[model samples]
Target chain A: MADSDELFSGLYQAVLSGDEDGAARLATRALDSGHSALETIERALIPGIREAGDLWEEGEYFLPELVTAAQAMKAAMAVLQPVLGAEAKSLSLGRVVIATVEGDIHDIGKSLVATMLSANGFEVIDEGAGVPVSRLIERAREVDADLVCASALLTTTMPRQRELVNAVRSAGLRAKVMVGGAPVTRGWAEQIGADGHADNALSAVNVARTLVGHRAAG
Target chain B: MEGLRPKLEMFTGEEADRVIDHALGVLSKVGFLVENGDAKALLREAGIEEKGARFHPPEAAVRQALGTVPARVCLFDRDGALAADLGGDRVHFDPGSAAIHILDPGTKRRRPPVTRDLCHLAWVTQACKNIAAQSTALVPSDVPESFGDRFRLHVALLNSKKPIVTGTFGTDAFDVMKRMLVAVRGSEKALTERPLAVFDCCPTAPLTWSELTCQALVDCARSAIPAELVSMPMGGATAPVTLREMVVQHCAESLSGVLIHQLACPGAPLIWGGSPAAFDMRHGTTPMGAIETMMVDLGNAQVGKRLGLPTHAYMGMSDAKVLDWQNGMESGIGAILAALSGINMISGPGMLDFETTQSLEKLVLDDQVCGMALRLSRGISLDSAGEAVELIRELTVLGNFLGHRHTRASFRREQFLPSRLVDRATHDDWEASGGADARDRAEGEVRGILARGNPAPPADDLGRDLDELIRAEARRLGIEALPEV
Candidate 1:
């Protein structure tokens, strides 16, 4: 059996390269080698995803690379989750329910934000595009979500973000509502009573961390 | 080409001489406090002595410094192309700099800008036809406060091909910012040969030079970068209440900057520029859009030109919070007057709310305003009068000159056709387009320009070097990750 450093590097390289099969294989190897699932995740998978996030922010990695890395992280998580059981819950930064507001079918921005949030250690529940505000709030309540993010790409559909914020508040949910998209601005976020706003996917993770009261990574 | 150009002169030649004389007198009698030790040492080398904590330069020292200063300063784009030529009667424009907040296009309210906002601004500036250079327009709140100065310049170099008009905050900021420019320009020598930026070094009001600003001026001169002296003298507040005294004070401060820069490195490029405002006693604010402020700017530039040096002014900006009639009135009048006065570089196209906020929508709208001002400065060309008479003789009989070849050949040159931002359509046509207001139209234009993306992104190797340098600096400052551009 490989030593711990070599085994962890194998998993990290697997995730960084977006090789899902290799990630699952290395994750199992680490666990079979007497390493706890939490140690495997903390020492291997999380560092891999954070490096990918850094590369994406540095402009060296594109969207396709980032999306695939997220997939590899998910595959590794699938292999490790059962052993960790409820301890898996503590590994995530927070639970976030993300969606595009109603009447807006633009999914590229929302999907990118979801992938970024997930890679940055948030347990992202992506409800996809054109989701109604009521269903979004309902999903947040179902997951006991810490944050709910809504994206509206058009000027006409932007008011839906405001609706999501109001619904989340009126429902007496503890989830912080965050807004974004093509036409959304920090001013719009303030006007609609959102907890925070991010202009792009990379910053979305930081905003989410801040909203959930986590110490944001430097 | 030889036709007389329309011009606006705030002072006659004799009056300009009188202003310079008064400025020299002020420098000699009431010396400016030199905050930086090196700057004071340079002045001492030039036969100026510090008395009572001030450096009182004699007339000969000022003259010697003025004699070596270059009359023109040229700026190059990121790809080493000539972007703007700042010389006699040549008008170039860039947006205002260092705004803490940006006016959101969607909500029309002001908020702190981020990296993406600054990158979008660089793309917009790259696409503008009349705005020739980019400014470090917004201070991104996401970056560490110490990194803001170089980070703004880094973003501009990455996203735009135009030369940047930028500045530094602290004494230590100039070196790293210069390194970024050097990387883009291939080497320090290459950057010096074709300067990619002009650093705005501002002296505080009331004849005091802060240590940081004085150091920036020294660094800019030594690096062969153009140092734009921005002496902001507010009438009735920091300066004398009267306009003439305000103008004289502006001159004295600017001349002191010139002396310091030239004493550091003789024949270095420097621009005689200012953002002086007429203080409003009623509100205790400096109104940049006031006519009195514009006069102070023009008077200062007039002195700069009389000294045979390049000139700059902060004009064509509004004090209005939103795009409205007041915005239009102030922006238009300032642009026209600045152009007519032949200010070499105008630096306030997108500023609003007393220069604290920048609106990208207003920036696109102001591009058209600058276009019209440039057209007006061309005046009437009498080069083809005989041809015009012949066409008139032929068209008088037919009563239909629309199809005339002469009209066809001259219409494009004779007219300045504005973009969709200027509403020239019929009422029905306007309504057909959803009756969008100027703000909406401006927003659409900004979207279109940004959609086109960066026309002149840096090359891959250059881009990588820039990223590595910025990342290393950010890490040194304890910023593990910077927001993507």
Candidate 2:
């Protein structure tokens, strides 16, 4: 293989194998050899991550491998992003602000959703647990977030999810509100006027993407 | 004796010690926040440093707590008979608990279970030979939320002779339950000596002990009632994603519970127990039947055994919404794992939908599963007297033992004769019989048991006294009548 082909293949293997340092090193070497950042990302990093996702869906890889692969892609992107400039925004599906709602300290569901979202190419901002309705809306506005996801494990805290939706609406934020947790059912989401609800984390990505698509179309 | 008992170990001695060391570090460095005032005082008395509500007990204090707790806890039946020995390799099975909804056998839809539903559940649990104990399976939706726990205890006491594994909703409810226990066992002294039930007190996951649970733990310890500390750590969410990390967190949480209980009363009976499971990232459900969940149970039980304490776990349950094939597979797998692991009290059969729903049919189905698991746990006998060598020699030429007396005598002990719920008929016979699945047969069995009447209803006068107690409690709680049967 040519030197450039070998470099691309090296970057691909690094990302596929979840070697963050190697991915960053190969991306740096490729850039130093006068290779365009866009080509390196499109030809090497993206394909590697896509294959990792495929392996994950096919059960050949688990969460650890998928997470590490995502980490490796992020490492490569760190080297290429500055040079790519405006093109970096196109790589992520959408920006999401996820948090466990106020009065509820449970964050496992929210964190899982955030991880799944990030693994699927969405830029996720985890606000942590006990996030008030006002803070979620404020953060969404600050990040220009396309989706605000609120999770609550307790039945008592589920009403706070509705409050989140109302808070976004009253604040006149353009972001869509999504609610989920052990108790937050789809009917409850509709009752609270949320744009979407996901029963679990993996499907949360699809729901977020569809919400983003709807926003773009509308 | 140790060699005779079949056991499952997830961690070696060195690994278990490491996990304990890590848990001790967590207790010291990243201590839990104790919201209860009395609990804070007790921890302070036990040499736990306090920073406002946060408590960091020293490793010595935890070891002391473990030392003071009795290695064995024997629960007695309502008649003051020893029902279960929850220690060593002794294993018991109970239905899953605290379910808000009951899967209606007739309609097959989830609905709020009434007091009658709880009674029926207790009755069916009593009928199951393999179900060693009963539980407060359903929170009777008809009762006031304040009195639900007490009412569940009342119904279980009236309907079942077996000792119950139950929990309280609040401190006040715990007091009421203690009174109900007193009513059943005749007096507070008798109740304490031969406790008819064990209270399952849960600490909030990720090392947080809430005020209510802390209060319940203290009460159980003080009253000499066996307290089963259920520290449910959801892996990958509230706890570490790795099973080992989750086990470490579970150790910390359960160790904290032991500290509180022992501080309340030294030499008290405390169970090292939990219901930890991997957080299913795919659909975000904490599946009870996940193999990882069973491994956590086995691993945690091993750690508990290393400390010489009785163990408990929430296993033999499924996340499936219905009593389908998925339910059978999950429940059966969990049952076998928990039994083989020799957990003292395996409490999670008959639960579905992440343990939110209870089904009588599922309970019947799980009874069969428990029977099979128990038979397997009995292991193979090596009695030279009954080795069957002579019988085999005699039958070597004929190739038949069916006509021999040894076959007739040994079959009952050696073979697991499954119930009708487990279909063994040929395909053609099955189709001719009705083509009913396990669920269908289970539903039929549930109807038969309920229709046959409660096998052990409380006697007339005692029943009246129990009724009066419930009514008085209900009236005190500002309710008019006990939901009529």
Candidate 3:
């Protein structure tokens, strides 16, 4: 039998080099070697990609490089989807359906959160740009999503953030919600009844995780 | 019907003229203080005499030099369409200036930015259609050399087919930029009449310019390039605590710029431009999102419009690091206001971190907003906005307007339909389509733009000359020429 440890290291290196095929191949080999899929992903891929994050912060890397590495890691994760089905539950980060609210249609900030969450082990259900409050709530329920990340860039459209929160309540899901964008602040987040707030993408992940934990504890 | 154009009298008038005249008197007599050595050297080359602490550009010499400036210019595009008309009512957008650092990979911290960064930034700007003109993100010093002049010319080569808005460091670069402009418009006279570039000459916050800016006023004027007298006054920081006082300082500095510039080159196109804001006491940062920032943006343009001078202001920029709701609100409102106000050449897109960092996402988003704002200036036509009553009638109580002739005609061009920015579908439709949200769509959009390299060819052979001029300059400054990424 092949050594799972060595196979896992290969998965890490493939992702770091942005080789999607290599990463998926290595990920499958490790899975076949009877290595726990969750263990391989958590110990190998997560740490390796986060190191890329560190490299980015250190100025030794830029966005193109980070994005490439993230892409490869996501490719590997996608390959593991069918095989790891029920076993994936324990490793899964609560899914958050993220979108920008209607009447305002900028989405890059919201995408960053999706990336961050996906990298951090979330099964992010992205309702690509310009989601109406009604759709956002319905999608969150359909995905069994624990959180909804609503981003609105325009002041004219900021009210839609609040409308999403209200729509969630009216739907009786009251799923933990978070709001962000250029005009959004902690004050506005509270005003709109979001369960949590993230000032940026990095914070959004931690906040999303914490919100889910809080709801589960309740 | 009263047009949507902003009223100049409400913001500036005879009172502005008097205040500006007083400020000019202060400038002629007291002059300005200088601390930076290179700025000092440039001033001396431009004919200012340094007297210990001050560089006194004789008011007459300043006026004499100002006489050489040209007053009007028009930039043509690759298809010969009008791209931007400087020294006029057109409000064109450009990138941010003088970012000292970018997020570094090796250290996870910011360090001194180098020319390679500038080259990358230039390329990035080139790829972006929203960038009507350009600015250097930083000077090249990756290996430590005198690349200031070469850097300016290089950026002109890399970014603009439209007339450039740039500046120089020393007398040596004056001709280099001149050569570069010649390369763009195709003649020395074209540089003057067609107006390929506008040299930025800034006044120190509050009331004065160090000797270099004053000397630059004269030099830029004599050079026959339009000079943008940018005032960066902040309420309660480097300026008086009041917004009015900040405006006064801005007016004063601009008049002082005009006084010296007119002296050097009279009737040259001098724009009143600025990056004014209120100082946030809590954070010790200038709040570019503050109401005062908008006031300064609107107010200074008012001052220039009153003088019948071309205007520019550092507006339409969000301090937001990413394209979030706050980013949209700050940038969308600010940019829309800038267009409606009738300020010519508003320069702030792709600006972030209080004018220190640049984000690709923010830049594209800003452009989308810029598209919407520019359209705002055209005003909603009565013919097209569709008779509201008629539209209601057309929509017979139960019938949908989805495939209506009016809707079909107007949907594609009249409305600003966003890609990856907005959603316009039923809930079920949104859910079925990857169920992805705006952010997801934006992320995909950003990935797409960067992946498909958008390269515009150099406007002319002058672009090649500009490149050579800049490379020669970098070598002379002891810096390696930036390599194309």
Candidate 4:
């Protein structure tokens, strides 16, 4: 095999194995050998992350493994972004501000959705737990976010999610609002006049993409 | 005692002692936040010092609490018959409590269970022989949120005759439930003598006791009702990552509960129980079927036994959302391990999806699993003087004992006869019988049981009285009637 072919194969293997340092080194080597950054990403990094997602759906890989693989891909992206300035702008998906609503301390569901969104190439700003409605809207406006996701685990705290939607509407923010949790249902979302709802993390990514009109990259 | 009593031990003697010492150290040095003012006063009287919200109780106070708690708690049925003696190696099974949804067999969809669903659950629980007790399994979504717990208890008391394992939403609801029990048992004294239910009170994980749960604990102790302290620590989430460290945290939380219960009323019956599970990193949910969760339960049971208290643990459940092979495997493994561990009063049999959903078919299927676990716990019995040796010698020459007296006498004792739900037929026979899986057979069984109705329904006047009481409580809560399905 040629030197560039060997280098691309090495980078693929590194991302697949969730080796961050190895992925970084291989990306640097491929670039040093005069290989185009976009070609390397299209041929190696994207395919590696896609394969990892497939493994996750097949139950062969779990969240930790998927997160580490995404980290490896991000490590390589860190090395390639500056070189392909105009192409990097095209790579951006959309920005999302996610949080567990006020008076609720549970954040696992929200954090999982954020991770899945990030893995799918979205810019996720996690505001953490017990975030008030005004703060979430303020942060969404500050980041020029495309969507705001709110989660609540308890029945008493579910009304806060509806309040968040109302807050966004009253503030005249353009960001679409999505709501979810153990107690939140599609009916509740529609009743609250939110934009979208998802039952789990995997579907949350698709819902967010659809809400923002960003089709997933092949 | 006709059967063998097996025990599952996870920690050595030194290891157990070390864990207890570490728990005591946590109580004395690190302390825990007491959110209830009444609880703080009781702990202060017991020599616990308070600094802001945190209270530091010495080891001697915990030891005194342990000494005052009863070693055995006896639960009685509605007829005042002893149903379960939660002591020693005696183990019992009950369905899980507080499921939000029921997986409907007809639609195969998850929906919020109503009051009628709870009544049907009580009826099904009554029909299952292996299930020793009943629970307020589903939270009725039709009732007012404040009246959910009380309404569950009222429905259970009217529908089933077995003793119940239940809990309250807060102190006021606990008081109302006590009145309901009094109305059923005829008086407060009668109810106290033969308590028809044991209250489950939980302390927050990582050593925090909330105000409402603390108040409930104290009320249960003062009322002479048996209180089971459920300290649920989610491993790798609210608790330490390692099973051993989780066990230590469980010990500290349970120990703190005992101290508060004993301080309220010395010599009250107290049980050490928990529903701990390892948090799944992938799904972000606690998987009850994980082996590490079982290990934590076993370790906590061992520590409770060492302290000479009745033990309980949540097991015999599955994380699978449906009743498939995964459900069978996970429920079977959990049931067998909990039975072998000799944990008193194991919960979570009919639960699925990490205890969020309940299914009637799964409850019927778990009956067979519990029967098999009970059979395994029975071990081998020597019937006669030279039963084994002489029977072998006599059958050795014949090569068959179908007609022998020994065969007739010992077959029932030696072998377990499973129900129709368990497949024992040959391949062609099973195929000829429509090739139904366990779930299908269980569904049929459930329909048959529900069709027959409850064998011992409450008297008409008593039922009317109970309904009136529930309605009156709803009226007090500013609701006219419960929502109809």
Candidate 5:
């Protein structure tokens, strides 16, 4: 077996290289070559990228550099995701379909949530930017997705994010509707009848996991 | 029925007078507290007397002290060319207004804008005629990282052409921007004498300061980077509940910045830019484009204009995402009202998503809207029965003036023509043309701009040195293995 140290070193190099494509290639190769996906992630990928975030916070790395390194590490993880199942469980902790909902063309928030979810080992089907209600539901059903995470930031678009939950309900796939964004709040979540809500990307980790748990028990 | 002549402000003469009058009231009765005893004396000698912690400045003296600050200043590029007339006519899209995401080309993900993207944005803005100045978009995250060279790269990449409005890293951000200006201009003295950058040093409102804000102000004043003192108070939350109370808090905070500007270097221009939003009690969010917010918006500028302070207010943004009916209604109304109220500078255009996201399409769309708002403030001309006269005459003759020479001459110049933003096309045409909504088209446009336009980068040698400098700065800050710039 190759030394874990060498593997970690390559991962770190791949991250700093801002070569998302290269990092994904190496992650897949590492998985195929008998190294555990979780190990590579815990030992290298997450740590390497997180190091960049820490550095950025410390003023060592600025925004462009930190963002690029995160992209590289996240890209690498994208490849290993399919191979990340445990012996007793499914390939994903949760099946999530996330999108920036209708009338909300700004997907920066949705994009961040997707990346963080991808990092935390959630099987995320990211419907590209500006997804309408029908498409979000159709995709969720197609994937048999456990969670549909909708993001909206505008006062006008806030209704659309709420509408996703209703559309999913009408389609009879409303069992696990999740909604969030700057305009979204705990009160709004209850008002919209959503099963789950996360204020930010980090809390989204726990929320998605909890939703998946609800699905499994059901 | 004209009552007064045209001032530089296009707001109706009556409205402009009221705005100035309101600002005078704020300056006098609620005179801003001079933080230092010496500066307190300056306000007093100018007939601004103190009682307890609060001080009151009479209108006459406040106007004279304000006279010390240049009402109008011109931004100049490295080549010593005029960039923009700061006080009127133009609304410059200052680069970087607190964007958290840098969309990664490879991953299609959103992450913090790094040094490279910050510099890349700077280079892009430097080359962009639409963008008059550069701002350090929320680098690596919030304003907390001002101490890092993130702010330095922001100024350096802007070195090519764009006159800068950059913040320094930490309290030393002002010093760093000056040094960067020197690097580009080839003289420290030149930068100090004719500052290229305007430091947007924001004071934490409701009277508080982190070490960084306090220090940045002092250095920014000392360095002579024309500083716009921005005080943002989220009313009912950050400051007092009422709009008037909020404006009072806003004035006090901005006045602190003015005091620093005078104390550090007298005669240095300091603007009264207060971005106070009325907080929505139910949600704990500031509805930035709400009517109450705009009321505070008008009042904030009212106070500034009255004090003869170069007025700046947070205006021209919507809480909506797309170019939907709501986006148009909210932003159009808010922006026009703010402009007609006679605000000199307005920010938060192209802002969206409860004021978090920045849409390039919204930016372009708002620019067109700003054009409309500015023209609207000019009001109607009564001199010899203006625009309506010729059009009405045409109606009596040809039934349509569209084919007339008068129509042909005025159409393009009179109206703010939008390209690809406003869907004037019929449903059939819109659908036939890929059915791309404004958002899709905007996304396509953003991609096209990024792909086709290459902003001139810093010289290769400077680029290398920049990387080394960032690495060294990181090492000192204890972040290892920073990716390439």
Candidate 6:
């Protein structure tokens, strides 16, 4: 059997190269070799994705590379998720339920934010686009979500973001609300009683981490 | 006396008809979900049938509405002086309104704007010669949320002499706002005779008009006040994915609004205006600066012009978060395009961050951009061609036009002399003058204008009445004092 150092590095390399199959294999191997699921994720998968994020930030990597690296990280998590189970919930930065508000069909920004949160070790439940405020709150309650991220692409639909905030607060859920979109501003977010607002996907992640009191992963 | 004015047409005659045809079809088939009772009754009078909470105006209704709409809208200053003519090839500019944050010049941080910020905005706008009107640009946080709409207009009226481009947040604010305007004009009849503000009434994208905004539209039309139809269609999101289709959606929405307004009061003045953006798929943001967004705006305006109506567009703004190169490039391009298209009352200067924030410095800088754009739209003049040939012949051997009488007489008319914010100095001279960037220079300009004090405050009695109105409203909201300007 390979040493612990070799197993972690192999997993890291697989994730960095966006080799989903290799990432799953190495994760399984690490788990079988007696390393904890948390350790496998922390020591390899998180670092790999963090490096990819860094590379993207520094202009060394583009979007496609970043997305693929995230895919590989997700593959490794798929293996760790069942084994880790309830404990894996603690390993996540936070649980986020994200969606594009109802009556607005825009989804690219919300999807990007969801993918980014997932890549950064946050448990993300993406509701896709045109999700009603009630469903969003219901899902947040179901998951005991740490944050509810709502995106609205139109001035008409922005009222729904406010509705989401009101619904969450009325239900007495602990989840914080975050809103974003083309027409959304920090002021609008604050005015609507949302906990936070981000203008772009990267900022959304940062804002999410800040709201949940989580330090940057890796 | 007519110089060859430059023009930009985004649609051919047939293309415009195609857009209008589709828009009419959408109104007849897809329909708009209008929630206002008065608007519904008006549409019902115009042969529009309400089907399942949506009003579908037939083509004849749309055509009849279009025919009744005044081809021009005139705005007056607070002093009842004619300020702007929204008609044929006359372009005016106002700062984008309703931004919630102000980029504080001292800290360079964006914070919730207060009364002082709004006053400062008015002062600088008054001093900007190229900016033709004032906007209720900042939503002051100190006031109650419901009072924001009229409070902004009140502050603007007291601080600046220019006509305002403003809107209402609550349906109740409309009458209070109209009363304030009446106070300024000395009576309701005078206010109606010379409208001092153009209220923006936005229709939600994908054929929806909210109750609040629709009520504002009906109120404006019935009151004989001009309403600017701000149809905002974020392409591929609230609107169709295709650019042309986005323009079609914008027209359909605005056309439905026109039918409601004209049916309420025929011959009512309205500007077929919009704030549509091209959806940037990669970023999931509506980029106002994108060329495609400009195309949608121009195309929308082209349709308005084709129908013999005045037009407005939310152009000359940037989505950049700061006063940077991106801001300059985007704003400059939008200004030129809007001007070349001959859009009347272009409504976006001093806007940044997706129209969420306003900067005093950017306002001063965009004033120069607007000046240059207005000059560009004037095009080159063959009117001066014969005189130029004579000057050249007279100075053939001297090679010195600088000292010539013709050069001295015509230089101001021939060239657009930009402000100091535009750096045309020698590199060494620029270095000697502090080596400041555009933002730094703009900061200085804003400071200089503010230091000059309010250029056009209202008369003392009028100002007092306006203040009392706002104070009473604040008192009603359980507020004791307003922030000092």
Put down candidate 4 lDDT per residue, B96-171, tens digits, no spaces: 7769999999888789999889988998999888888899999988887678888899988877898999988856
| Local accuracy of candidate 4 as per-residue lDDT tens digits, A81-113 | 789878766766789999999999887778778
Off by over 4 Å in 6: A1-218
Q: What is the lDDT of residue B57 in candidate 5?
A: 56
Q: Which window of 10 residues has the lowest lDDT sum in candidate 2 chain B?
A: B398-407
Write one digit per residue (lDDT tens) for candidate 1, span A1-218.
45889999989998887778899999998889899999998998889988987886665655556666777888898888899988977877999999988887788788878877887788999998899988998899999999999999999999999888889889999999999887787778899889999877777888899999998776
Alpha-carbon shift of residue A85 in model 5 (angstroms): 86
- Identify the superior model by TM-score, candidate 4 or candidate 6: 6
lDDT of 2 by residue, A55-127 (tens): 7555465545555676678788889878987876777788999999889988667876786687566888999
TM-score of chain B of 2: 0.97
Interface RMSD of 1: 24.5
RMSD list, candidates in order: 20.5, 27.8, 16.7, 27.2, 21.0, 27.6
- Tell me which residue pairs clash in candidate 6: none
Which run of 10 residues does model 1 chain A get worst, by summed lDDT? Answer: A56-65
TM-score of chain A of each: 0.94, 0.83, 0.86, 0.87, 0.74, 0.89
CAPRI category for model 4: incorrect
Stretches of candidate 3 above 4 Å error? A1-218, B1-3, B6-73, B77-81, B87-89, B103-131, B138-145, B169-171, B321-325, B384-404, B423-443, B459-464, B480-482
* CA lDDT, candidate 5, residue B84: 60
Pairs clashing within candidate 2: A200-B283
Q: Ten consecutive residues with minimal summed lDDT in candidate 2 chain A? A: A56-65
Select the stronger candidate by DockQ from 1 and 3: 3
lDDT of 3 by residue, B36-147 (tens): 4545565676777666676566656544533444433455442334667755456677776655555443343445666555554555565555557767555555633344
In candidate 5 chain B, where is summed lDDT lowest over 10 consecutive residues?
Answer: B2-11
The DockQ value obtained for model 3 is 0.01
lDDT of 5 at B478: 64
Q: On a 0 to 100 scale, what is the lDDT of residue B204 in model 1? A: 90
